[model samples]
Target: MSDPTALLQHTETRYLLCRASDIGEGEARGFGPLAGSRRKIIVLRRNGVLHAWRDACPHYSTGTPMAWKTDAYMNGDKTHLTCHSHHALFDMETGQCILGPCLGQQLTRVNIVVGDEGDVFVAGPTEEI
Candidate 1:
């Protein structure tokens, strides 16, 4: 197969984020798959399920990213997600703001696809930012 990201144009808007192996268990990776404009999205595996979300925090104007460090999404206890900007806690499964200024808000979910070939991709059209 050709380089997946380079082949992404043929798939329209869908861009390959990474292979399943790249994320492993309880890991998250970022991808810029929106028309090559550096749109950052995060894909993570939690409890055997895969989730994709826009890498934007709900409390800020630009909606900052959740992780303070690279791929370090989970809190020190590994129980919830902690924001890099303000240390807000969010539910890993639901993306709900459990503690902090944005309580009751949620991180925007982005659709994802897992190809039979083991590659992961951003799926279909997403709500524009």
Candidate 2:
């Protein structure tokens, strides 16, 4: 898999961000340059599957690049990503804002595929920056 950052820098359509071993089960790490933009992304491992979504919180878009102070986490149930800024909970599988002040909204989903070699890479269309 190609380097994710380098892919972004080179404006490649897609690239690899992490190895499967880099993320522990039920944990999430942040990455960036989805679709070749500056926006950050949250790459998560849930129930043995790898998923990626825009890191911004829906309530106020406060995570990663937007607000460096905010903290986001996977819910204790390991089913959703919760933003500490406003307690908004997003569905882990779909990136939908399922609870809190922003119900009906969602974090932008980024297409990604997990390679047989345990690498994770961006796979499809990039969401708007």
Candidate 3:
């Protein structure tokens, strides 16, 4: 049989986000599958690299957003991602929870692809999360 994995490959949807330049170093922005949808995600630009994560707080059973302010998901030092609700900290480079509640847990990393023209896109899970 043809490899089942190969058959299902490239099937996930990749949604276009914003330009790579839009998110500056040490900055982050939030996006969702649709307007007025509570399901959300946040992307960060650190050291000129892009990292995407589901905007969910593992500390909270309901999985709430990490930012207190819009698109402001970093700690004061801009070194790690912070959940404003309970101060859960996560490693921006790896999305692993480094401090606060849910320690050792991690922020769900989204599969993102940056185009040659600097456009950002998330592959898979196009529906409202």
Candidate 4:
């Protein structure tokens, strides 16, 4: 099996995942080609800012990829993201496990920067939090 941890450490090829405008304010979405691996990423727009986190739920280690009407938003509340598998709610701003069995645990944060052209790029190191 591939070491997820090491793959995360070495995956630094950030790509222009999407346009900032595409993700409306308080909306959450998912992007892929995450730094170390080829897994999908969960990106959220909270308080008018973009935040990216690994789509996997810490409790069950299930990959919650970006999909419409699925584990995308939190119970019609666009303010937070949710894992469809167990209804685990995560803070859009901090990617913290605000609800569910993984309370106190946080999703892996992906470093990204929005360019002046309104393009989102997965830039910088992956933080293991």
Q: What TM-score should be assigned to candidate 2?
A: 0.70
Best by lDDT: 3
Off by over 4 Å in 4: 1-13, 34-38, 61-71, 125-129
- Select the stronger candidate by lDDT from 2 and 4: 2
RMSD of 1: 4.9
CA-lDDT, candidates in order: 0.77, 0.71, 0.80, 0.69
Candidate 4: give its CA RMSD in angstroms.
8.0
Candidate 4's residue-wise lDDT over 1-129, tens digit each? 999988666454546778888787777776665456645666677777788787677776655443445435565655557766677777778778888777888877877778789888777644431
- Model 3 TM-score relative to the real fold: 0.80
What ordering of candidates by lDDT runs from best to worst? 3, 1, 2, 4
Tens-digit lDDT track of model 2 for 1-129: 988888666445557778878878788877756556766677887888888887777676554332234333665566678766567778788887788888898887877777788778777656564
Cα deviation of 20, candidate 3, in Å? 0.5
TM-score of 1: 0.81
Error of 1 at 37 (Å): 4.6
Question: For residues 1-129, what per-residue lDDT tens digits would candidate 3 score against the true structure?
Answer: 788776456533456778889888888999874444565778888878998888988887768888888888888887789999888889888988999989998887888888788878777665534
Clash totals in order: 2, 0, 0, 2
Evaluation by lDDT, superior candidate among 1 and 3: 3
User: Which regions of candidate 1 fall more than 4 Å away from where they truly are?
Assistant: 1-12, 36-39, 126-129
Q: Candidate 2, 14: how far from true, in Å?
A: 2.6
Off by over 4 Å in 2: 1-13, 34-36, 61-72, 75-79, 127-129
- Which prediction has more favorable TM-score, 3 or 4? 3
What is the TM-score of each predicted model, taking all chains together? 0.81, 0.70, 0.80, 0.73
